[model samples]
Target: MAKIIPFKAVRPTRDKVTLVASRSYQSYTQAELEARMDYNPFSFLHIVNPGYKYHKDIKGKDRYTLVKNRYLEFKEDGIFIQDEKPSYYIYKIVNRDGLTFSGIIAAAGTEDYQTDVIKKHEDTIEYRENIFKDYLKTVGFNAEPVLLTYPDNKIVANIISEIQKERSEYEFTTTYRDTHYLWKLDDKDSIRTISLEFEKMKTIYIADGHHRSASSVLLAEQLKSENKKHTGNEPYNYFMSFLIPESELKIHEFNRLVKDLNGLSKETFLIKLDAIFRIENRGNQLYEPSKKHHFSMYLDGDFYSLFLRKNNDAFKTALDALDTQILYKKVLEPILGISDLRNDTRIAYSHGKNDMATIKSKVDSGEFAVGFGLVAITVKELKAIADEGLTMPPKSTYIEPKLRSGVTIYEF
Candidate 1:
């Protein structure tokens, strides 16, 4: 069974939350980052990018120490405070597109991850995991929560609906026009109910943040080895997570763009694809795949729809049915000779939110030779993949709601 617990989160003052909450550091461009740090001293960017204050770029352990210092400064200056008691935070986000997401912010046990109770659909890079584990060790807190999804239960949903009827603790909108609300659930009865409901669940799937989750587990193992009197209930054993229902997850496909066709001419490439797909010329019109196993292709100033041939025997495993995997097997690898999706210089990905416009522009500008579009993977498909201990290719899915940093801090 899955294990989760509430923690006393350190959060910004209610009055300053609008200013202190920020998107991830990488989400901002250099100009936007500089402007926010220059104009808004209270912004959380000031905490993460502590080097900006000294006009120097800090790296490695030095940056981690500085990050901790900046965080402590915020608490000392009365901008941040710890909750009086452990509580599950009910967080909700309504994006600019008017899509709403609701979830509980709690600490998930690393043991659950180790035992496969907290399932994962994406693979994590070991070096990246180690880098973050070291940073977490020095900083001693997690500012962003990993996104997790669970089977929907009436007991939890009812509790959330009741609590939302009351005024929220933090209600503010970001510059991106996404409205966020957070409510504290400290009552023992409701907390127990939520805990019991989750305990009944057999597994929960990771919707995003694979590296963060892996790093937290690594940190837990390192801390356990160092402490002679380590307890299973130590803060290091748990990591912060935002738990939502499966239905609330928003998934988008990642369209592909290739710089070259592996020395094959346009006509020859189409001829090779004919063996696996029934090709239709879409001719200068932007086309998107409407169903699974179907694909939209853009090559040489025109669009084409490629349908998978019937009676094809590719479906052997959960991963095999995935459109991204299918593209790799039938086209990207055999036809184009591009094997490494992650390290290959010939391939690039665009989030489906951009649709085909970005792909069209990239190809039209002579930057890329061909582009491919795929339908977003369904929740059922994602669950099956994780259930069977399989991982998707890099950049297969773009998930939301993208969370904010410094909204709720998990301290060890």
Candidate 2:
């Protein structure tokens, strides 16, 4: 069973939360980071980008120590406070597109990840896992919560609906046009109810933040081994997570762009593709794939529809049947001579939110030779892949309710 618990979170002061909460550091462009650090004194960027004050880039263990110092400064300045009691945070996000997501922010047991109660569909780099684990050891807190999803439960949904009726403790809108609402579930009854509901669940899938989840487990292992009087109840044994129902997850596809069409000319490429797909000329009109095994391609100033030929490719596992893998196997490798999706300089990817015109423009600018659009994978497919111990290709899904850091922090 899944184990999730409330924690005494360190959070921004109620009044300053809107200013102090920030999107993940890497999400910001260099100019955006500089502007926020320069103009907004309360922005969380100031804490994470401590080097900005010294006008030097700090890295490794030094950067970690500086981050801890900067975090302390925030607490000392009365910008942040620790909750008096452990609480489960009910977080709701409504994006500019009118899509809404509601979740419970709690500490998920790292042992659950080890036992397959909390599952992952993506592989994590060991180097990244180690780097983040060491950083967590030095910094002593996690601000951004890993996203986890479970099968929708009516009882949990009803509980959330009732709690949301009350005025939220923190209600603010960010510059990104997303409104965030947070409510504390500190009362024993509410906390116990939510915990019990999760305990009844057999598994929860990692919707995003595979590395964060893995790193948290690594930190837990290291801390447990180092402490002579080890206790399973220690804070390091749990990682911060935002638990949402599968129905609330918003998934978008990552469209592909390639620099060249291998060595094949346009005519020869189409002929080679005909072996696996029923090709249709879509002319200059922007096309989008509407279903699985269907694809939209743009090349030489025109769009085309490529439908997978019935019973063409064999599927031995969930990973084998994924659209991304199929594209890599049939088209990217056999025709385009592109094998490594992650390291290939010949390729680029755009989120589905960006339309085909964006893909076309890149090709038109002579930066890429062709582009492909695909339908986003469904939550069901993601769960299936993870259940089978399978991982998706890089950038398989762009999940949202992209959280803000320093909103509710887990400190070890």
Q: Largest lDDT belongs to which candidate? A: 1
Residue 39, candidate 1: Cα error in Å is: 0.7
Q: What is the lDDT of residue 333 in candidate 2?
A: 80
Write the residue-wise lDDT of candidate 2 on 1-412 in tens digits. 9999999999998899999999999999999999988888988888788899899998899989999999999999999999999999999999999999999999999999999999999988999999999999999999999999999998888888989999999999999899999998898988888889999999999999999999999999999999999979999999999999999999999999999988889999999989999999989888999999999999999999999998786799988889988998888987898888888899899999998899999999999999999989999899999999999999889999799999999999
Per-residue lDDT, model 1, residue 136, is 98
> Cα deviation of 282 in candidate 1 (Å)?
0.9
C-alpha RMSD by candidate, in order: 0.8, 0.9
User: Can you give the TM-score per candidate against the true fold?
Assistant: 0.99, 0.99
CA shift at 161, candidate 2, in angstroms? 1.0
What lDDT tens digits, residue by residue, belong to model 1 across residues 1-412?
Answer: 8888999999999999999999999999999999999999999999899999899999999999999999999999999999999999999999999999999999999999999999999989999999999999999999999999999999999999999999999999998999999999999999999999999999999999999999999999999999999989999999999999999999999999999999999999999999999999989888999999999999998999999998664588999999999999899998898899999999999989998878999999999999999999988999999999999999999999999999999998
